[model samples]
Target: MQMTKRSLPRATPEQVGIVAKQVIAFLDDVRKHESELHSFMLLRHGQVAAEGWWAPYTPELPHMLFSLSKSFTSTAIGMAVHEGIITLDDTVVSFFPDDLPGDVSEHLAAMQIRHLLMMGTGHDQDTMDALIAAEDGNWVRAFLELPVPHEPGTHFLYNTGATYMLSAILQKVSGRTLIDYLTPRLFEPLCIENPTWDICPRGINTGGFGLNVTTEDIAKFGQLYLQKGLWNGVRIIDEEWVNEATSKQISNGDGGDSDWAQGYGYQFWRCRHEIYRGDGAFGQFCIVMPEQDAVIAITAGTGDMQVILNSVWDHLLPGFLPDPVVTDESSVALSEYLAKLQLEVPQLRSESMLEAQVSGKRYEIEQDQMEQAPFPLKDFCIEFDTDSARLTLKLECEDSIILGREHWLSESTITIEGKDTRIAGSFTWKSEAELVLTLQAIETPFRVTLEVHFIDDAVTIHSRYNVGWDKVNTVHGRAVD
Candidate 1:
C-alpha cells in the first residue's frame, strides 16, 4: 500500500487520552526545574498533542543534534543491508582493503559490521581523538590502525569512531555520502527536506555527530519507529530492522535503574518503562514510548540529562489515560498556556546612573590583554535609543555592530567567525553602571552573555557561555580618550 506523507495531525491533550490539566502541569514543571530545555514536542496516537519552542529557539530553525546523529547513521546502514549492498556479518576490513594496516590483529580481523552497530568494537575508551588527530585526515585508515585490545563483540565501548566507520562503509559501497544516501531513502519518505549533516575534512559525513534538524523532524522519526517503520500506511523501512535496532543488543552496565545502564541497541539506548531514545549531548532527545503509544522530542542545553527524563516519568507518564477525558476549561487553559510560552529573559529594571554618561563612550583594552582571547575585542562602545540599542565592537582589524531591543529581537544575519548565523538578543540595565546583553544563536545550542560594568575611568567586561570550551573571563578596558 502506498502511504500518504503529510503533516502530523493536531489534537487536544484530552483527545489523546491525556488530561489537559496534567499536561499543563508537566509543562510548568519543565519550566520551573529544567531551565535549559529549549524546545519539546509531545505526540500521542499519531497526533501532536502539544508543542513549544523556547524564546530564540523557534520551530523554523534546525538545532544541532550532536550524538543523536548516530541513530540516523544506523538507519542508513539498515537500509543498505536491506538492499543487499552489505551484510552485518561482513568483515570490517573487506570494504577498505587498500586502507587496512599491513599487520591487522586477530581482533581487528574478527571485527564485523554488527560489532560496530552494537558498540562492541572492543576498545576500552573512545578512540575519536586519534581519528581527529590523524595526519592525513583519513579517519577510516586511522581507526583501523588503532589496537582493539579485547576481541570484537566481547567488550562494549561507547565508540563514536565505530559509528563513523559505518558511515564510511555505507559511502564506499553505495557510492554516496551518508547524507546523500539517506536523502532519497529516509528523509524524502518522511517529508523531511534540506536536512544538514556536518562533514569531515575528507568529505565524509560525521556519522557519530553533527546532524541538524527541527524538533518536529525528531518527532516524526520517533513516530516512524513507533509505527514499526510504517509511515502513514506504507513501510518505509522493514519492521524487522526497526525491531532489531531498538531491541537491547548489549548490556552497557549494572546501572541498576538508570536508563543508560539498562542496555544499548544499534545506535539507540534502551530506557526504563520500555522506552528507547536517540539522545545527544546537552539533552537533544527523541524518546519513543511503546507502552504509552507516545513520542517526546526535546532540544536543550543542560548538563543534567537524567533530570529531564525523570521529569517526564514523574509528570507525563501518569497523565496518559486509557480513555480520552475531555474538559473544556482545562483544554482552553492548556492551549493558551502553550501559545504564550517563552523563555524568560534575565534582567533588572533599575535605571542605570551612568546610562547617559557612558552611552556612546568608546573604551579600549590593552593589546597584550586580548592577544590570547577568543574574540580578541580591542575597543567597544554602546549606544542606546528609546526602544533599541547598538553595541559596536572593534576586533583585531574590523568593527562589528550588534543591534538589539529591550525585548527579544530576531536578527537574520549575525556574523560569527565569518559565517552568517541567526541570532536573537535582548539587553537590560542591571544597575546604574552595569548593562547585561544576552545573545542566543537560534540555529545552535549556545548563548553568550556580555556584562559591561562602568566605573570612573575604566570598564570591566565579563563574558559567559551556556556551553563551550571557554570559561567565564573578565577583560579590563580604559576610556579611549
Candidate 2:
C-alpha cells in the first residue's frame, strides 16, 4: 500500500502543532544545515504532516537503502525464531559443516547465531566486504572459513558480511529465501507491497544492504517495531523477541556519546533517546521511539550518516511521547503548516538582467572542495539557460545532469532531473547579482539550500545541513565561452 493517510485517534490539537512547527522550521533551514549532503524522507504519525523535495532529488522515486536491509533480515530471523525453526543460540557451523576452515579454533567453534545478530563475530581481521569477495564457491562458506581472531562475545565489529551470513543461515534452516519467508509474515501483514531487495551473483539476498524501497514502506516497518511487531491487532512477531532484539546487546565502540553512547542491538543501534534505529549508508534511517509511540522513516544519500542521527536525537526526540494530549493552538498551527507544504514547478523568469551578465561573458566556479576526495572525476562544467532558468552540468568522470527552469520572476525554483535522480529546488536572487538556491528532495527527509555568490568571473558556493561544515563538496567551474 502507498503512504495513505491514517487518522489520528484520540489526540488533542496542540501536540500536532508542535510536530508541524518543528518540521516546517526544519525544512526552512535546508542551506544552514547542509541539506545538499543527503536525501531525507520523514513521516509523522502515519501522515504526510510535513514534506519537502530538494534539488538533486524528488519524490515518486526510489533510493538505495544500503545497510538498512540488515534490520529487515534480522526481523525475518525473529519471526523464524518464534516459529521454532531455529534459536538464537544456534551455531553457525551447523548450517554448513563441510565449509568450515581447516582448523576451527575454540573461539570460532563457539560462535553462535546471536553472535551474528550482535555483530560480535570475534573475527577481527576479516571484514564483511572481504568475506563476500572471497573466491570461495559460497559467500557464507567463505565467511565460515575465516579465522576467528577473538572469542565471539569479546569483540564487536560493524560487519555487513555477518548479516549476509545470517540471511544464508536462515535460508538453510527454513528452506526458503528471506523474501519468500518474510513475504507473508512481514511484508504482506504490514502492507508493504512489491518491496525489492538485491541479490548477490550467488542468488542470495544482499543481506547487509542493497534494499530499495519507498519512504512510506520504511515508515511501515518502523510502525511495526514501534508497536512491538503487532499489526492491526495481529501479532506477527513475538513480543519477547522484539524486546530482546532491540535492547543493547553489544557496545559498538565506534559510536560516540549521547545518541551514539547508548550501544548497539541485534542489527540495530541503541540511540540516546531510548530509541533504536536501523540506519544505512549516507542516511537511510528507520527510527522508532517506543516511548513516543511514533515512527520516523527516512531515506537518504549522504557521506556522514551520524549527522542525521544527531539531528533526530537533538531536535526530534524530546518532543515525542507515547500519547500526546492535543492542544488547539498547536493543532491549528500544524494544520496551517500542513496546508502550507506544497511541491510545484515554478514559472520561468526570463534572465533579462542576467542577459548583460551572460552576453559574451566568461564565468568560472572557484574554490571547489570535497569533504572526502571525489575519485574518478577531477573536473566539472556549468552552463546556464537564460530563458528557462536551467543549468546544464557535466562532471569530468561522473554523471551528466540538468536543472530545469523556475518559470517566473516570482517563481524561484529549479527542477534537477539527472542521469540517475530527479531533484528540484527554489531559487531567489536575494542580491543584485548573488543567487540563493533552495533544494528539497521529495525522496528524502532533508533539504539542501545553497547560496551562489557571483563574482567578476567566479561563483562561490557554500551550504550546511544542520551539522558541522567540515564536510563539504565544493567545486569550481569555469564558463568555457
Candidate 3:
C-alpha cells in the first residue's frame, strides 16, 4: 500500500479559488476570539491553498489528536470489511467469546460492529471511564460486562468505549494491532510518517483516543477522503466506503444552529454546509467540505472550540468560489501574514529586585500543605542570568530547562506527564515582587504558566493552563537554601 513521490500540490489561494482576504479574515477572527490554534492547513481542488504553524509549534512535530483517532479507527474497520476480514453484521460478542461476561444479556448479544461504528452501542452513558477502572485490566471483559440497557442501533450516545471495542474486535480478527493493520492499508498509502498511538495496559491501541500526527498528515487524510479514497489516481480505499462512512448514519441531536446537533456518521460528525468532519478535544479538526472540494485541518488548545468553527463559517466559507480568482497583491499579503504567524511571548513589565534576592535559592514544598497543587514536584529552584533563567524541578528525579527573559528559548527539555518531551519557554518579571514563567510543550497543544510570588522566606506559585481546565492552582513553599 506504500506509494512513492506523491505529495499534495501547493498553490496560491487565488489559484485554488479561495479568497486570500477572507482567509486572512479567518486568521484575524481566530486571534480576535483568543483561540490558541497551533497549526492550520487549507486545501481546495486537491492542492494546498494556505498553511501556517504558530511558532513553537513547527511543521515537523506530531501533535496529540485526542478523539480524532476515532476516525482513523473507523477507516481500518472499513478496510477490514472491504478485505472480507470482518462484516458490519458481525456480532460484537462473537469476536471475543472467551472475554464475554458470565451471562450475556439479549441487548449485549445483539450489539453489532455497525452499531459500534455509529456510536450506538446501546449503553445509556459513556462506558470508557468504568471500563478503564475495572481494576482487573481486562478491558475487553470489562466492556462486555457493562450493562446494555437499550437495543443496539436504537439509542444515540457519544460513547468512546464503542470505538475501543471496534479496535479490540479488529485486533482480534486480524491478529494485529490497529496501527500494524493500518500501516500498509492507510498510513503508508497516505505517506503519514511514524505516527504514534497510545496503547492500553493490555497492549491494544487505545482506539478512542491518543493519536499523534503532524498537521500536514491530517490534511492529507482529509484530502484523501475529499478525493473519495483516491491518492494520485491510485485507489487507496474504495470510493463506496468513503461515500458511506461520511454520510449521516444516526441522529445525534436536534437540527439547530449548533453544529453538534447536525448528525453523526461512521466516525465523522455531520456538519452544516454539507460538510463532515473528524474533530478532537480542545479543537483539533479535519473538516471536509465536499461541495466546495475543500478540506481544512487544524490543531489548537482552546476551551471554546465552537469559536473556531464559527470563524470558519463566518469568513472562510464565503471565499470558496466556483472559479479560481485572478492573482492579486492580496495573495502576497496573505502569504506574508501566514509566514510571520507566532504566539506571543511573555515580556518583562518591571525589573524584579527579588530576582537577585532569591536567585539560586531552593524552595521545598510539603505536599500535604498545598491548597491546590497543579504540579507534583517536591522542590524548585531558579538561577538567573543576564538574558535567561534556568529552572530546576525535583520530584522522583531532577529536571531542568532554560527560559529566555523576554523571548522563547527553543530546544529546551522537560518531563511532562511522565513523558520526556521538547519545550519552548519564556519568563517575565510582573513586578518587583513576582515572576511569571511560561512553558509550551512544542509537540502538543499545551501551555503551562506559573506566577511565583516571593515574600519574606517563602514563595507561593500559581499555575494554570491556557485551555481545558483554566482554574489557577496554588502551592506554597519555604526557602531551603
Candidate 4:
C-alpha cells in the first residue's frame, strides 16, 4: 500500500476550511510581531492540509532545518538498530578509539549509546569542544573527548554534541553514510527527493543541524512517525523503537515546570497532551499528535519557537475533535478563507512579454566589496538579461580567481571577483515590473526593491537596497518599440 501521488487523501472542503481560517488568523497576528518569521506550511494525515508564504518567501525554496536534524539522525540510528547493525548499549569509546581521552572517568566510561540518544551526555557546553578546539571538521572525536560529569542516566543536559557522536557510531557500525543508509528504507518510501545536507570537515552530515529540506517533506516525516513508522502498510521504523524514541526519558528546560512540558525522549520534545515533536532552532517543527492522528510541520526564520507552538495549541488544537463532527456555519467560513489564500505573485505588468534587448541595459557599477580587504576586480558592468530580466554580469576570464576552503566554524565569507559585478542574490526579480528581493545576510533580513519607471525615452530601473529612497540604475529599450 505504498502511497501514490493520487492515493493521498485530500482534506474535505470542510476540513480545509476549518484549517484555513486558523492559518489566516495565526499569520495575521505573527506579522504584527514584526519578526523574521519567513515561511510556513501545515499538513494533516499525509496531505498538504494548508500552506502559505509571505513577502520574500515561496514554497519551492529550501530552508535550513537546524537541530531538527537530530530527529532525522535518530531515525537513521533506528533503522540501523532494526537491521541489527548496532545496539543501543554499545559504548561511545568503542566507535572512535583514536579520539578517546586517556583519563576518561568511570561515569564517562559507563556511557552507552542510549545516553547519547536521550541527550544525557555530560558536557558543560555542547559546542564548546568543537568551537574552542576547532573541531568543526572532525566533530565526532572532538565531541567524544569532552568531559562527561553526570552518570549516564542521572541527569539530562541538552547536548547536541552527544547526537553528533551517535551519528559517528552509526557510521562506524553500519559502514554507510547517514543519507545513503536512510535513502532506500526511509526517504524514497516518503517520496522526498533531492535533500541537501551540509557536511562537516570530516564529511559526515552534521547530525545535530545543517540538514536542508522542504516544509512539505518534514510534514511527511511527521506523518510517518505519527503512523508509528508505518507508510502505507509497510513498517519502516520498528514499533518498539518509535515508542521508545518518543516516550519521555528525561526532563528538559531549566524552568523545572510540569513534566509534560519539560520531558524529552530520544531526540524528540514532549509537549502538552502527550504530544512530542522534532523542533529546530529557528522555528522548524514537526509535531506528531498520535492520539489526535494529526501532524503539523512548520519552517520559519523567526527566533520564537515557543510562540509558534503556543499559537498552534491555541488555534489548531481546538479543531482536532469536533464532537458530533458539526457540518455547517463554522465549516463554510473556514473553506472560504482557505480558498482566498493566494501567492500574490505579481505579473510582469510591462506591456509586452518580448525580449527587450540588452545593449541599452549596461550600467557602470560603483561596487563596495565589504571591509575584508579588497582583493581584485572591484570595477564591473551590470548586465541585465533582456529575455528573463534576471540581472547578471558576465565576468571577464581574468577575474575568475580562486579562494581556498572556507570554514563555517566561525564567521565565514567568500568574495567572488568579477569584471561585471552581479546584483546581489537578494537583489532579485521574479518579474520585470514587480521586483523585490529580500536578503537575510546579517542580523536582520534586508529587502532590495527595483521599481521600473517609464521616463520619456526609456524604462529606468530604480533600486532601494538600504533605505526606501530610490537610486536609478539605468534605462533600457525604446519607449514604444
Candidate 5:
C-alpha cells in the first residue's frame, strides 16, 4: 500500500488553536541562541500548523536520529508482544541460547525483555563501547558476557546495548530485520519512504541509534502515539501498548524541572509539562504533547538540548489555547520569516594575494600528523578558480569537493559515518595567509570546519566539528611539488 502524499493536511496556526506570534517567539529564541536547527515541524489536531527547513537542509532529505531510533525499536518490540511472538516476561537469555556466555550469572539470567525496553537491564554502565570493540565482532556474545551486577528491573541505566538486544530478540523470534518487520506495519502505513538504518557487522540494525528519516516521518511517528496508535482510523498497534510504551516505567534519577527528570518510558524520555519525547544526541526530537493535542518535531546540531525545550515551554506552550485567536498580523509575519529561513554562509573577507601563489599546491602530511585529523586524510591539494575552488582530499582515493566563492556548493558523494550523503561547503579568506573551509553534512547535524594557515613552505590545518567528542585536531603538511 502506497500513501497518496507523504504529508499531513496543512492548516493555519489559528485554525489549529495556536497563535502565530508565539511560534515566532519560539523561532526567535532559537535564533537568539544560534541553535543550529536543520528543520522544525509543528502539528496540532492532526494538521500541520508550521514547518520550515533551513537552506541546504531540505525537507525531503532524511536526518540521522541517533537514540531517537530506540523509540522505533521499542515499537517493534511492542508489536512482537502484541502478536504473541514474544512476551515482556520472556528471559533475555531464552532467545539466544547459542550466544549465551559460558557461565551466565543469576542477574544475567534474570534479565527480561521488559528490562531492556525500559533500560533497566541491571548494567552499571553503557555497554556500547565494549560491544563495538568486541574482538570477534560478535556483539551479542559481547553483551551476554558482560556482568549484570544489579537484579533486572532494579537498576536504571541508559544502556543502548540493551536496546540492541531487543532488536536481536525480535529478529530471532520473527525471522526478519527490524526495518523489514516494521515496513508493512508502520512505515507503509505512515508513508515513510526509503528510510535507512545502519547495521552492525553482523547485519543487525543498530537499534539504539543510526536510524534516518525525514522530519515529517518523525512527526508522524509522534502523531501515531498521540492518537493511541491509530492512523487514518485504522489500528496500527494496540492502544494498550501505546499507553504502556509512553507511561513512566522507571525513575531515571534525573531530578529537577529538567525534562530528563520527568522519568523514562519504553525508550522515550518523559519531559516537563506532561510531555514525552524520543530524542537523539545533538537534538533530534519527536515531542508528543497529548494534553495540548500536538506534536513538535525538530532536527538540530546544538550543544544544549534543554534550551530548545525551554523555548517551546516559554514561548509556544501558552499559545496552544482551547479556541482560536485572531492572528492575521502575526500569521503574515511568521509566513515571511519562515520563507526567509536559511543557514548563514561563510563570506569571503577580501581577496588574498597569497591565493595565486598556493593555487595548485599539493600538501603531503606525515602519518603522525595525519593521525590528528578526524578523517584519515593522507594528503590534500587546493585548486583555485575564478568562481569556485576545488578541495582534493586523499582518503582511500582522491575525493574532490567544490566550494563556491560566494555561496555554498554541494557534493553528493562525500562519505560521512560510512554513508554517502550530500555535503554543502563554502570557502572564505580569514586573512591574507589563512583560509577557512566549512563543510556541512546536509543530512546530519554535523559540520567540519578546516582552518588552513599558510606560512613559508609549510601549512598548518586545524579541523573542528561543531558538535562532537573532540573539539579540534591539528595537522602539519609541507608543500609538495
Candidate 6:
C-alpha cells in the first residue's frame, strides 16, 4: 500500500468547545509539578488544539513507547481476526506444535489467543526474565515449558510474556513480523512513517513493549480507535474489533477511583470518567475520551502517573463545552503561551572565582572514590576556551568530553553509562567553588546532572539522574599535576 501524507487539522481550543484558559492551566500545572514531562498533544473533534515538546525532546524524534506497544499489538491481532487468519478462541499451543513442551498441562492447553490479549495468562508473575534468559534463546519453547499456575481465563496478571506470545502467534499465522504486517494496513493509512519495534532473538516483535513513535503518532492511534477504526473515511480495522478491544475484557481490580484500578481491556486500561488509555512505564499515555470526542497523547518520565491523569480530569475534562465557545481574550493568551512553551535552561552566573584554579587542571581519582560512582573513574580534566568549556572524563580506559555552555549546546557524540549517545548539555556555576553540568540524552527521556565541587585542592563529584535512580553517586579526586 502506498503511504499518503496526512496531518490532523489545527484548531483553537475554544473553536472545539474547549476552554483555552483551562488548557493553559493544565499545562501550567504539569510544568510546576511534572518536571519530567517530555511532550503533550491534545486533540478535539479530530483537530489539534495544543501541542508542545520540552526542550531536548522534539516532536520529530520517536520516543520509546514502552508498554504502550501492547495496544498496537492488540490492534494487529484484531486485524488478523478480521481477515480470518486466526480466531480469538484458537489454542496458543496449536500454532506452535514443534515448540510445545512434551506434555502440555490442562491450564496451558486451555489458554487461548483471547486470554493473551486480555493479560489473562495464568502465570502469577511476569515471565519475561525466563523467556529472555532461555539458554537456547528460543523464547517460544521457553514460554511453553513454563507451568501455568492457574486457569488461563480466570486470572488477571499484567503479563508482557502473554503479549509476546500473541505476537509470536501472529507471526506464525501471518508469516510477517508485526511491524511489517501493520505498515501497509494501520501505519500507512495513518501516515505513521518509518515506525520501529524491537525484535526478539527469534525475530518476533516484542509485543508488549519496545515501540518508538512520536507523540503525534500516538495521538493518531488513539484518534483511530476513538473513530472506531475509521481514518479519513476509510475502514482500516473492523468496527466490531475496536469495540471489543476497547471495552473491558477482564476485571483487573475492584472498580476504584484510580484509573488503573478501573479495568483492563485488550491491552488497554479503562480510566475514570468514561475514558480508556494505553500507557507505558514512566508515563507514555494515549488517552481516548469518547463522550467528549477528544484524545490526549503524552510522553513523560515522571514517577507519579496518577498526578498527570488527575490534572487532565481537573483542568481539561470540564473545559469540554457542548458547543464551541466564543473567542475571548483568554483564547489569544493561550495561543501565545503555547507558542512560547519551553523547558527552561538552568540559570547560573557565568563567572566563577575557582575558574582560574580548575582551568586546565587534571585530577586523579582515588581507588576508593570509584566505589560510590556509577562508572569507574580513573581521572578527569576541566578545560575552558573562549567559545566553549569541556570536561574530559576518563572511565577506566574510555575517555569522553562533555561540552558545557551558558546555553544548551548539542553534542553529536558522548559516552554515558558506557553507551555512545547524542546529548545536549549546559553548564552553570552554582557558587564560586561549585560548577553544575546538565546533560540530556536527546534520544531518550533522561538527563544526568554532575556537580563538581572545588574544596581546597580536592575536587568532589556528585552525579544523579533526572528520573529512575534515587541515590546520588559521589567521587572524590585530587589534582594530579
Q: What lDDT score goes with residue 30 in model 2?
A: 38
lDDT of 4 by residue, 1-481 (tens): 2467522455652454344455556665555554445455555545555555443344555566888889999999888888888888888877778777777778878888888898876555675357336534667666666667778866787787787777777777877777877789888888777776656667776678767766777777888898888988888899898999998887776433342356889999888877889988767788887766777777665655677776777777765554224356645664565444422322333223222442234333234421112112222222334222233222233222111111001121222331122121332234544343222222112333444433344444444444222343432333322
lDDT of 2: 0.63
TM-score to true structure, per model:
0.92, 0.70, 0.96, 0.71, 0.97, 0.90
Looking at model 4, the pairs that clash are: 17-334, 17-335, 137-201, 380-419
Supply candidate 2's per-residue lDDT for 275: 80
Name the candidate, 1 or 5, with the larger TM-score value: 5
**Model 1 per-residue lDDT tens digits across residues 1-481:** 1334646778878888988777777788867775587888999988899898887678878888999999999999999999999999999999999999999999999999999999999888887999999999999999999999999888889999999999999999999999999998889888887799888789999999989889988999999999999986777788999999999999898867688898899999999888999999988999999999999999998777888888888888999998988677988898888777776676586356577788888899776776544556678788877766777776545444454556777754556655566767778888777889887777777877888888987999887878753677678899975
Residue 22 of model 1: what lDDT?
A: 77
Model 1 residue pairs with clashes: 352-432, 353-432
Flag the better candidate by lDDT, 1 or 4.
Answer: 1
Candidate maximizing lDDT: 5
In candidate 5, what are the lDDT values of residues 336-368, reduced to their tens digit? 999888888878674688999988899988778
lDDT of 3 by residue, 66-143 (tens): 889999999999999999989999999998888988999999999999999998889999999987897988888999
What lDDT does the true structure give each of the candidates?
0.85, 0.63, 0.88, 0.60, 0.89, 0.85
For candidate 1, the per-residue lDDT at 364 reads 91
Candidate numbers, best TM-score first, in rank order: 5, 3, 1, 6, 4, 2
> Could you give me the TM-score of model 2 versus the true structure?
0.70
When summed lDDT is taken over every stretch of 10 residues in candidate 2, the lowest stretch is 370-379
- The digit string of per-residue lDDT tens for model 2 on 1-481 reads 1233332122232344335445444544433455333334444454334443333344445666777888999999998888898998888888888788788788878989999999899987536667657775478777877778888977888888888888888888888878888899988777666667767667788788867776667777887787777777788788998898899999876555656557788899898667899988667788887766567766654555666666666566555544544554555665565444444433333242653564344344443443223211233333455443443332332333334445212222322222233445455555566555544444443345555556666655555442223444455445556
Model 1 stretches with alpha carbons more than 4 Å out:
1-6, 350-353, 360-379, 394-405, 417-419, 456-458, 468-470, 478-481
Error of 3 at 303 (Å): 1.1
* Residue 292 in candidate 2, Cα distance off native in Å: 1.7
